[model samples]
Target: MQGPLLLPGLCFLLSLFGAVTQKTKTSCAKCPANASCVNNTHCTCDHGYTSGSGQKLFTFPLETCNDTTSSKTTQGRKELQKIVDKFESFLTNQTLRSTEERQEISSTVTTILRDVESKVLETALKAPEQKVLKIQNGSLAIETRVITDNCSEERKTFNLNVQMNSMDIGCNDIIQGDTQGPSAIAFISYSSLGNIINATFFEEMDKKDQVYLNSQVVSAAIGPKRNVSLSKSVTLTFQHVKKEDPVLTIITYVGLSVSLLCLLLAALTFLLCKAIQNTSTSLHLHLSLCLFLAHLLFLVGIDRTEPKMLCSIIAGALHYLYLAAFTWMLLEGLHLFLTARNLTVVNYSSINRLMKWIMFPVGYGVPAVTVAISAASRPHLYGTADRCWLHLDQGFIWSFLGPVCAIFSVNLVLFILVFWILKRKLSSLNSEVSTIQNTRMLAFKATAQLFILGCTWCLGLLQVGPAAQVMAYLFAIINSLQGFFIFLVYCLLSQQVQKQYRKWFREIVKSKSESETYTLSSKMGPDSKPSEGDVFPGQVKIKY
Candidate 1:
């Protein structure tokens, strides 16, 4: 019985092995070009290829995988245009001024744009079934996900993907749809689309070299129900929406914190120190106050997008405050130039009087009028979905940038005049203030004043092509710490203020010693003997 059972089992195993071998042999058969056999009997096109436009033949020999680049160029553009046209319809029919609606529009438009862009990238790069995108620590899978609108109960689904090599670094940094490339670049040309779409050309530290060869811009005029065409000018790039650099965030917050501390100290010093109270310190005080309020409001309320009126009010306040700060800065420069012209005059007494009369009205009034004009004209352009600042549409940003640039230009001229006058006239004035005569001190003060008077913002003007990132970091760092610079130059570095601080410190120490001595003496009874080194009645000789 055991032998019979073993024979049957061996027969069954042999039959199973024969079936497996047959399947393997069938799958190993030669397949059509750009196609492969799978599951022993079926043929499928290779990755990046699709089957020919015909019915499958019995022998599976007629089907072929064809390249999709030309077909994709024709069909993909049609689909993409439809998406853009949909957005254009929405823009035409609906008002998107509210912060929430604007954000929804931005996020939706970019999502559509990036999806089509990714398909274009796959065609360009000839990538396979996997997404061409190469995120640092994410999967290669692609699937649609829901985008739930926060402002309303609306929800839509979309996929975010890109096609690029993992080895290609900084090819996707996506700087404002700006790129220089041997590779074609794709971007959403309209500024209203927001920063959701981006592309990067240079890798880190490679920006300074090969600065000129950027790709062309393709303008798509997607009108309501309009047919759109794709041009060869534009290509697509990818950017992952990730949190900002932790290091930069830390640096910004830390710098702002230091600036706030310094501003407070400077304000207190200006208020209390009678010795340093002067026209310069007064200008510094107002500048410090404006900056303090601006930065504080920015840190706290810049992203408070809800309650739209509140956000607009905050934007208006920020605009006014920052403009006022720059206005005071202009006053500082004018006063400095006047001081240089009146070098022989002791204490800048007459200049000080002249400034006091005009500073308040000019410093506060100009910003008020500018804001009032802006409010009266385009009141709705105050806040954006992302930031509580002037809108960039319809040349509205110029309301701020225009005044700033003018002030910067005037300040530049003032700074140059002051420097020239100081160099030419310093040696001739014997009775000039000691602070203004020391060449090193004077040079340092002049440079510091230049920065404080908003010359550093000129760095923004140089933010083009290759030097954009460098100039951006410099501008952010220097301007963010403007309050600290004012305090350093006007309060901590001033000889008069330093002297006052030292005097105050000495007095504090002296009083502390006296208090300790009195406590010690009081602990002893009236009949108790004084220490051996005691001076006249209850006086202990204190050494400071």
Candidate 2:
């Protein structure tokens, strides 16, 4: 009886142990392909694979393992690789290469590069959270940077590298477009592209030794537009080619410096000569101040590219200062219109009071508001890599140009109205010779002022067509010498200012003569002062 009972118990124990081993095997058997069980407990996707559920280790039987690199970034790489392969095949295949002309080959390569850039930027934008994506193969390489933080102070620009080529671009260029949210830039480099579309494709490469394809053919672009032009110039640091002309820069500096000095003198004249310190002179004074500050800041800090935030601040300041100048020009127009309207009135108090009330707010507040709106909307567009000025991207320059054009138009209309009013006033008051002469003088000064303050800026807009080069030079010279024009028109031309200048000059000469006489008397010693001619006025001669 004992032997039979022991045998049954042993068989039962064996059956129970076998059931436990079967359960452990079943647990691991449920894991999908590209995944394995860990310690017979949980499932983990293999290297280069990810679980559909996004977990490293998962026990759910429904979870599937997928290729981790097959996401958007991989898709981008594959697209770029496909383009490279197709181009390579086209280049290598004798049948294809033999039929294509040199121009055709160049065109085909250009199309490929543009396509690669567009595809890479599009892919990077699709996954902006990635921030950066780099893909490399034997024939091609690409690197992308996504700027989604609204270009904070710490990240105002970006530098990207592919192969041995690199690009430096401002964040604003990438972020400025119709689309909102994140922006991305892609740099694609082709290892074999330079060989086919090398220096030969460049029409400017006339000299063999002077120019050659020193680096791999690289393409850069920003999404979603992928425009060939950028608001800021992208600095492409090729391995062996580089260049800049400083002649224009030097001209600009010297011209602006002279204008700045003239502006200072004109401002001093306007402030000190109480005779010319009326509403019109005040307008000239403010305009001179604005131009003075703008030119001074530009001379000092326009090229200061480091500490990007400071550059941006300088740019904002320039924008405001220039806008303020134009605003004052508008005020001048209004004042001229009011003065012309009230030319026959005895008490010009109302016009003066009206001007005093509105000039300050309109001159300064309007620009401040304009800058604030622009900055709040797109602050990144304020500064660029090369200069601290308004950017040309997305019609951003219009912030300055728009106000300028409007002011110019209004000034022009006011000018016409002023002349109209002056014409009637002069016609009716023909017998009053003094009034007619004063009105004619006023008309002449208005014409000159209008030309200096409003019309010269039109040259900037005319910087296109056949006359672009000429217009550019004219714009530079006339606009840079704006301070000189102001001083010339307002101070040197005004009879009152001339009289004051002459009086000041005479006083200076007299003071110098008196100073010399005192020096001579001192040198001659106390006992040697015998000449009565040496006694200057306002000095009491002591009698012993």
Candidate 3:
């Protein structure tokens, strides 16, 4: 009886398990191809596929799975190809060709180039998984490269070719800062654009030789900012271009080198010569230091276009240093004005204290803030294609030029005010010959300083019209040798500084003579040792 009962119970359990397994298989049988049923209750698309309704899990039998990876690539290619088609249409349009004014044609060409570059870069960034995309339409061609991984040590730059035009860009330009995601660059070439914007647009071109566009009009840009300028100059390889004069390059290098040396000497004099250590000398020292660094960087790295991030950093540093130099110059003018105003005061301890309080903040902090704001707003304008300097596009150069002009104007006003004050002081002190002479000397120095530090910069703005060539040369020559002017005025011309220099020279000569005499006596033998009177003991030595 027990065996019979146990057999019946086991059969009933086996039958129940079989019925459940059959139900589960029937439910999963409804799942479509390229999809799998989960837990016998819901369906999920297989790898490399997505559900039509975008649901990860679904019970609907009508849902279908689609290949998404292939579709995305197709969509990205179509989008880029569409850009090429649109650009080709724009260039071939009859309305664009009918335009007469060269300026209008040039402006339209620029707008078209920018638009094409921006759209290509945008599309590439949106579909960064498509690492490389190239499309060629009727008269236009575009190629894009997307970087999503760390650049190898061996490959610091990437090159993109479109038609006969090509661009070489630094890897860091695309990666930008430390962003660990994708960065994309687009290179575009227009076969017909050069016809519209030819050599005629360049006013500097010689009219004697018949010049025309010899290369395709090409544009290159990086996303997401898509600035007109690049951090490193994109080395554009085209069919035709001219070379710059080597003579001018040599002159520039030599001039800047000499100026750097002079600035160094001026800074040292301002620091070491206690006689000239005042608020004015402090201003001079800072000015010299700023110019020294600016010139040194300009001479060495101005044309360093590789490693885009480094070039941009160099450009920003140059911007800050030059602005700092001008700011210090403004401070110099302010100090000169204050000194002139308080000529009657025997001591300027109060003035010195005031300057000390405000000078560092205004002189250095102002430029730093200015550069920060400029960089934050339009970082792409920090470097250019030809040089590691502010780009002259979209009025971006005004970031540097605007401040310089304002400072120059303020310095000019201060100079005039100081001159007026000195005149009044001189007229009132006419009875005292010593006072008149001092006032006259101050006036002369003020006049010289104004020209040396402020007015010469005006030559840069005068580089237009028939005299432009003359003004360019003059500007380069005078401005490049600014350090020489500073050294001459602050160290060589100042009576107090001149005296200190003479004293230093005498001390150096005296030390050399004593050393020679001691060596001679030592060479004569032990019997010829110098006596106690001949040896100067415990004399205070200056540590320069």
Q: Per-residue lDDT tens digits of candidate 1, residues 1-544?
A: 8999999999999999998766655753666787777765667676556777543321345557786655664565555556556555544443442334435655765675565455444333333232222221011112211111221222211123322211121222211122222132222233223322221222223555633222222222111112233222232443222224566566667778888888888889989999977788798889889888888888888889666699899999999998998999899889878877776655666797899999999999999999999999988878865568886545788899999999988988988887887787655555455645554465577788877777677877786778877776777788778878888888787888899999999999999999877777786667887566555554556443
- Point to the candidate with the largest lDDT: 2
Q: What's model 3's TM-score?
A: 0.57
Please state the error at residue 42 of candidate 3 in Å. Answer: 48
Which lDDT tens digits does candidate 3 get at residues 1-544?
8999999999999999888767655667688779998987788998667999999997667789987767666766676567666666765575655665677766766776776777787677766767898876446678899887756553488888876567898887777766656788888777656645663375457788756566677777777764454577769898443234466567678778889999999999999998778788888888999999999999889989666688889999999999999999888889888988888887999999999999999999999999999999888667654468886544778899999999989989998899899878877834377667777878887888888877788898997789977777787888888888888877888888889988999999999889876666565566754444453343332232
Looking at model 2, report the run of 10 residues with the lowest lDDT sum.
Answer: 239-248
Clash count of each predicted structure: 8, 0, 0
Could you give the C-alpha RMSD of every candidate to the true structure, in order shown? 23.6, 15.1, 18.0
TM-scores of the candidates are 0.56, 0.58, 0.57
Per-residue lDDT, model 2, residue 95, is: 67
Ranked candidates, highest TM-score first: 2, 3, 1
In model 1, which regions exceed 4 Å deviation?
Answer: 1-243, 347-349, 427-443, 528-544
lDDT of each: 0.63, 0.80, 0.79
lDDT of 2 at 265: 98
Q: Which pairs of residues have clashing backbones in candidate 2?
A: none
